[model samples]
Target: MKDAQKPDHVSLNTLIMRLREGQFVIPDFQREFEWKPWDIKELMRSIFLDYYIGSLLLWKGKQENFNALSCERIYGYPKGNGNPVHIVLDGQQRLTAMYYAFLAPDVNLPNRANRALYFVHVDKFMAEEYDDAFNYDWLTRRWSKIIDNPEVQYEQHIFPLAIMGAGGWELPNWVQGYEQFWKNRTQEAEEAGDADAIEMAAKSTENAHLFGEHLKGITEQYQVAYIELDQDLAVDKVCDIFTQINSKGIRLDAFDLINALLKPKGLQLKHMWRAAASRLEFVETEKMNVYILQVMSILRQSYCSPKYLYFLLPGQEKPVRDPDGTRRKEVLITDAQDFEGRWHNAVDALQAAIKLLQHPHEFAAISSKYLPYVSILPVFASIQAHIKTIQASQRLDAQRKARHWYWASVFTNRYSGSVESTSARDFMDMKAWLQDDNAEPPLITEFKTRFKTLEFRKETKRGTSVYNGLFNLLVLMGARDWMSGNVTLADDLDDHHIVPKKWGAEHLQGKVIDTILNRTPLSAETNRHVISDRLPNQYLPDLIAENGEAAVRSILESHCISPAALAILLRDPFTAEDFEEFIAERQRTFQEAIETLLVKERLDLPVQLRELDEQIEQIELGLRKVIVAVLQADSQYELPSHILRNVKERIQRAAKKNAALDGDYYDTLEGKMEFCDLRELHDAIKTKALWPQFQPRFVNKETLNIKFGQLAELRNAIRHSRSADEITRKEGEAAILWFAKVLK
Candidate 1:
């Protein structure tokens, strides 16, 4: 039996060629294709990263063996004579994934509704972001066209993997075409004198060449190992060998290996887990087992990757780095007792963190499904443990800071990619913040800047972090059951539609009717009996009749629906326009609630600066109305010739530099005013012709110019995202009052 012998290697290019030619075949006994799309993406990523993807076991098939075993072509392979040379014994899943990705056959994945296609993001690949470089999409008509269109592919910086499997000069030709496409674009940008576009296109051209070389390297050099059994070997012997290989129990992960490694050191890692399992059972994720180890590593060395996790073993030295990276040392784990202590501490901390997540008064992730990011739990638990160790008076403040961090992380999708490094960095940043409140992490500021513009309408899916986090927010808001009028119990709540799905489907055509703006937490019973298949205008009156309007309004307020939104819902005509108004009003209410409860001090600006900022906004509004009215008072609504020549030309030049102003610049006079800075508005007013129209309101251009200058200084401070000094605020306040009186 030469069954267990030395393995030979085949390059990926050769393997793909063999697959296309139907040289490799699967025996009838092999399992059907079972890999998921994400699994296929990971395989592609590994191949690109040049990581070992294990080996294949094959039986060298003769005519007699092929006839006896009833060999079949791989799924999605064209049916033909096939002229099979080998029958696969192992690695069916990997080989099939490669075939599905590279070949991109016209078939849906197993048990999936839509056909899938794989792509490589050339920009991400060139940046060495292997995890995010590979992606797949449903083969809809739109995606099909996108993959086939070379211009669209170049614009998006993605490369179709199927070209590689097309087998001849197709890949190299496509790569060359991509490089030339960007080179031409760079030339066009240069001709247009757009420095930014020129830089972008030139960088894309360089990346194209780099990505092409990388792809060529992977295809021609990446190897797959395989062991072949002789054709002369009997079928019974081959069948027995396959059974022994496939009958293995559970596949080992890092945790299992670590458990065994700890046993010889007198640490029963498995026994500790058995003891702690009951406490963590409420989390309902298998990953909780390894998260314990990850948390331990994070608390010890501020890193939880596999390489750092190994340092937790007894007598293993963990390299410690100073903040400045100037000092470093290896600190050994003292003993098994020390390991056990860390394990227990991690367990306790994780328990506390889970309780906080499920607590209605805390982060309010009601259940596993409602948890915005399970991947963030390890760092979260470590932070919670640190909070407990602080002084009693400071613990509340520390917990509040932690809560802000959690919400910011959830909303920003901070843990979605490169989780290990992100977790470590956040842990370090948060630890610093907890000790010194002035050193807030960057995510809190990011959340504040983006919170107002968050597109709640796009959050239509239930399982995404933003969707689940919004639901959790409703639960935390103390959403009440309509019929029962009690606080919503976590386990009993469902994200039910405020506007019944049936009514919305009929009336809200072309609108995203299932957005979070239209959904809120309600008990299953309330959703079924109270609000079933009825509009809010229809069911809300019934609720008000049962409970008084005041109580019902209070209940609605708990769901972040303000009195204004309630009025919109209770409109008599209640057309689709009212529904849209209700959605907008409720979104505004949610923004207010989020600002008050979570992002209390986004910029941490002083109260005086905020009031001054609002004053400046009011002054600007007055100026815009006066300018537009003066311009439109005669025959047509237009800027005066001199003002247009000076102010409009300058604003248009600024628009070219700031892309955000392009749309406004091309619009009407009012739209152009929206893009105008305070100084530009002052320029228009101080123009010789326009000064006659404004002098009556302002009394004189000299005072107008001085007050406008003060307002401009204050506006500049606010726009540049900095606080005005006390002297500037005093002068700006005087100018605000002066303008308000004059405009009046």
Candidate 2:
């Protein structure tokens, strides 16, 4: 059933000789050579030991469907061609490694272009035992002085693996010169009075002769095994045989196949894609292939995806990429010649789309790092390319529509599935909206209102789409630092909590700290030094005393707080009861701020916003009682000093684990430790294993430990700048009710 015959044997010299003369070619379907230096070293070692590495699989074909360029690509290759070119279907990695190690002394890998061609010296190393076998340990791709040693002679010490064919250079092997070097080394060692060196030199002399003879036999006589498939086979059949026999498990990629297809037609994939992509500096070559294909599809069929680049069109009766096969439009370009002008426009449109995102600076909230969705770019570019010139009046309307789509897409997790499908639909939708005069964008308000999932989650970075959207929204509304006067920059901003996590953890079990309602963007420098886990209730007034109330309130309103909400939160000795009310009130303002983008209404922020000072006073007294109970349960004498000392130890331990979590309390131990707030005392106490001390009195150790862990986790979420909005909502009320039970 098979067209190919049994395996055949060919000398390494003969094989390379054929390769250099363009007699051998690598098929486009094969993966790029991926052997590292270790692999090369091992392969050479096996060959020197005369072990059977493997046979090369050659597909002898009448003609290639792809490029003939592949035929001329053997390293150290001569320009002339033989009658037929054999495609090496297998053993490419091993063959490439051999070439990199022994031959191709001038070729360099792309990254290390300045380096000399790879080599390994046989008789180069001298300090150790004189063995005929070359050490394959330092198998570096780059050249070194050791590999280029003057003592090494061709077919003797330094072996050349690549030079082959009629036109190749051959360096003569010197037998007498190798003997003279060892004799000279022996004389020098004798004069130095080193017996070991003398003995090694004499041994090197004998081994050099043996090694040289062995190298000569291998290069001149030994054969490298190979199998050549029948030339009468079809391209697809050859491909199937190649794939079935390939040991390296490299799958066929679209680009390689496409290049092969284009090569016969005198078109190069790299040249065509590069000419268009170099105009735009941001996208890389591999991605450019995708862009070009998408553009060509849009130009030809007006329906495209990056997947189109690899699809076998015009050749295959039905080329497939998408699970749902891409439907070719009736207007598809029948030939490649008709496709160029359209591809150029697609390139220009892609560039224009990037510019459109940057034009008014409002959209600059996204950078390459936090793009949220990359497919959005090319799809948007394609849509904008089809449209007429925009009127100035229509720009605002266009922006509103774009924003609605952006926010809705992010919050609703629209593109989490099939991006090409989503992009196709979105592109069509935008095209429809851009054409219609009476088009109204989807109500962002409805999306936000239906969004029950808008809760804070702890994350190391702000790369998520939701985080990106929220940051852009805050930037849209002028967010500023409460402590400093400077406008906040996201790069320098910290998502800071308003109510100190430490105090909330103590009184309210530290729940609700990571909520977007609690977290506001403040300058990192101000947040680090000013807010430092101290509640706004206490810190705001302290700041107001130093800097006037007007200065502080201005910054709060910019964070989307109403003046009334700010006043309620700013109350002195703000308690856990007041903390609950403050979070509830602040959440409402946040909602109103989001709604402003859609409806654009002013909220009537009443100045007499309820401040529960009496309830706050009662909560503070109750908290002091709880602290006194916790401390006195184990120790009754000099309770204030005992509490202070215990809290100091807890602060020192937490500061050790992560100094950032300490809120700069590490800088001044006496200041942080001496007569701090009840909340601070609670945080310090919670850090220690104190439930055993309170065992059988208030709660058991297990219950106390669980309660303490939940509270600590709440503080941890804030300390790490993670989301705890759900914790705040879930645990805030329960903690307050538990405290209410404890107080009763």
Using TM-score as the measure, the top candidate is 1
Cα lDDT tens digits, model 1, 546-646, are 88999998889989989999988888777888888888887788888777556753223344665666678778888898998898786444564555566
Judging by lDDT against the true structure, name the best candidate.
Answer: 1
Q: Candidate 1: lDDT over CA atoms?
A: 0.81
Quote model 2's TM-score. 0.41
How would you encode candidate 2's per-residue C-alpha lDDT over 100-132 as one tens digit per residue?
555553555434434333333446522222233
* TM-score per candidate, chains pooled: 0.53, 0.41
Residue 325 displacement in candidate 1 (angstroms): 7.2
State the C-alpha lDDT per candidate: 0.81, 0.55
Taking every candidate in turn, the Cα RMSD to the unseen true structure, in Å, is 12.9, 22.3
What's the number of clashes in each of the models? Answer: 0, 8
Error of 1 at 81 (Å): 30
| lDDT score of residue 594 within candidate 2 | 52
lDDT of 2 at 570: 74
